[model samples]
Target: MTNSISLLAEEQVPESYGWLAGGIGAVIVIALLVFWVASLISIIRSGYSVGVKILLAMAAFAYPFLGPLIWFLFARHKEHKTRMDR
Candidate 1:
């Protein structure tokens, strides 16, 4: 009985930490929003053609997190490479 009671107490989260989790979640969400907006801006300002811009914007809007990440990791680098080749 004592062991069970101890386990239950350990499983219960302290109220003090509840707000910490929420704050961390909010920060993560805000950061993602900022990243998504920046990616969209980059796409619009890029030298890519209108069709490419539209496609990239659509991808960013569609996938939210993954799209922007992929754009930064792959498309952005590809654009830079092409520009350097010119």
Candidate 2:
């Protein structure tokens, strides 16, 4: 009887986690889709330069981790005065 009770307890724990994970996954996917659409629309309206447009579009709709990388690397203006220029 004790073994059966432990098994039931273990099963309930995983079922709860499964629901939580599924909810989080759904939210991420929805946000990604919404951002992707908004980015495309803004890109079209502004008619930004190809490079800038690409960067903005990518930043607007990417995995949460990707936006910062794009911002630091390509989205911001590059420093024209390099050490070699000095």
Q: Model 1's lDDT to the true fold? A: 0.87
Query: What is the lDDT, from 0 to 100, of the residue 14 in candidate 2?
Result: 91
Looking at model 2, residue 31 earns an lDDT score of 83
Query: Clashes in model 1: which pairs?
Result: none
For model 1 the local lDDT of residue 29 reads 97
**Over the full model, what C-alpha lDDT does candidate 2 score relative to the true structure?**
0.60
Mark the regions of model 2 whose C-alpha exceeds 4 Å error after superposition.
1-13, 49-86
Tens digit of per-residue lDDT, candidate 1, span 14-64: 767867877999999999999999999998987777888899999999999
Worst 10 residues of 2 by lDDT: 77-86
Residue 55 C-alpha lDDT in model 1 = 95
Worst 10 residues of 1 by lDDT: 77-86
Kindly list the per-residue Cα lDDT of model 2 for residues 21-85, writing each as its tens digit: 77998999898666556546645455345776666666665644466444445534342332133
